[model samples]
Target: MADITVKVLEPAVSYDLLTLDELKTILGISTTDTSEDALLEMWIDQYSDVIATMCNRVFAREKVQETWRGDLPPQDCARVFLTHYPVVDADIESVTCNGATITDYEIENRSGKLTLFGSWSEPIVVVYSGGYLLPDEAPAALKTATGILVTGARSEMSRSTISGIKSISHRESRVQFFDESGGSSSGAGAIAAAGDTVNALLYKYMRFYV
Candidate 1:
């Protein structure tokens, strides 16, 4: 079989993995001032994208349409993996095989595995929703990882007093090291380490097709 192409139909209710209040608590800010809310919101969006990229998955539930081309599965095979995991039955709009609708397929929500009754033609299409249904369903480890990233980013922002440098020459090219096992690092490296942590937690939830 060929690679599957996925497209988002309807986005989730909330894109933020962590609420503003939760982020404030993580940053140890107890004040009621709303001055930094905008900044924090920006960080939340940035960190959310970073986490999603590292994990190769989305945290918020979203409707998606996926297409698979090439040869269909053999008779011996009964199942195929969806593009995303933690699927919901109600969110599965339809399953089509070569422009023909199919109703006998079984969906395994957590694994995002679809078991078809029989072999179908090529160019299979599936429409469904995937990812955590609610913010509470998001893993705590991921939330904590986001907190770590935001903290490092906030610290870096504080240390940088000047913004927008035009043509500053460097004597030597900068070299950076990354520890895939999530070791200690600094600046962007620190954020990468945090991302590694989040990816590890989300690894099991990712969908892998054979």
Candidate 2:
């Protein structure tokens, strides 16, 4: 038998595997839609219950495809079920955008219920200005860009932020996250472009609570 190639499904990286057109086809939607993000939204709108049933969690891309429903192809059906993931806001004690908009990112799963395994030992905040990044990647960027160089394990100061989060205030939105407390009242801080620029450099904040 000839060996077949199997592409990996890294739901964390949206570019892999399926496109919006693939998802649309699975949901029986028009491919003409300009925005792929919008098409995913449509899937949630029409099949909320079905999607919920598939929210089950798995460790690997192959595992995600393994949970596909009977009606659709493994990739297409799993992609539909794989479109969104729920954030257990309970784990999120307090969030500071640092001027970045707080938006929900959904990951679709076609399995059963999902339990996001992690330790709620402490509350953590992450900052991102460039292209979207994984949770682990965001914290590193936030630390370096905030003039707070930290590495290895938790440091003396980094350990403290977990306790006095709101106490550490921002003067103005440095990283385009106007919704963040650090933004300037004159409102230049509120500008996404300005904030993102400030966010790219350490001139933005004293430290981010990543």
Candidate 3:
């Protein structure tokens, strides 16, 4: 295994996994209610980013260039995993190593794994377009999870003033809030300690990577 860095060449036009209308429907807010549109939009963006972070993958399709650095083990030559999954074979523009294009490679469309044939060099770079189309094309469960997350955040905000709350906790359930320094009091722990339903919806999509 090696260190992988992904750089977006053309960022997705929108990172929204759930649309404004969809969110409004979840919240039971009328489509004509313009009073809270700004606030709602902010929450939508924040929560969408949070969901992606939690899943360790973006749901919006974008062009990207990924680079691999450091030494790779012998077994790694046969298979290298890409950061983003569900890659379409046609979306892979190129895979290069040592400044030359690699033609003897097979792409695992859904898993984002690349099987390289014969000898391979270090510092492999892969250029590809992956991820869901988003909002409209996002998985149904992901959209449901987004709605749950936003609704939970809204409910928490309505309960008390933000300045007075350090973290969210109820009974045995707890979710730590990051301080001004962007570090949580819990040190290394889950960013979201959502309810059982929310957790269940997100469990399958969760990715644990180095």
TM-score top scorer: 3
Instruction: Show the lowest summed lDDT stretch of 10 residues, model 2.
Output: 145-154
Question: On residues 1-86, what C-alpha lDDT tens digit does candidate 2 reach at each position?
Answer: 11112223333442122334544565455888665465354433333222112222211112111222223223211112221222
What's the CA RMSD for each of the models?
A: 8.0, 23.8, 9.0
List the candidates ranked by lDDT, beginning with the highest: 3, 1, 2
Off by over 4 Å in 1: 71-75, 134-136, 160-196, 206-210
lDDT of each: 0.74, 0.28, 0.79
**Residue pairs in clash, model 1:** none
The better-scoring model by lDDT among 1 and 3 is 3
TM-scores vs. true structure, each candidate:
0.75, 0.16, 0.77
Model 3 clash pairs are none
Which candidate number would show the highest lDDT if scored against the true structure? 3
Query: How well does model 2 score by local distance difference test?
Result: 0.28
Q: What is the lDDT of residue 192 in candidate 2?
A: 34
**Candidate 3, 1-210: lDDT as tens digits:** 478888999888888888999999999999898888888889889988988887888778889999887755564465677776779889999988878889898998877888888777777899999878877888888889888888877765664455466778899999876444235564321224455676788888777754
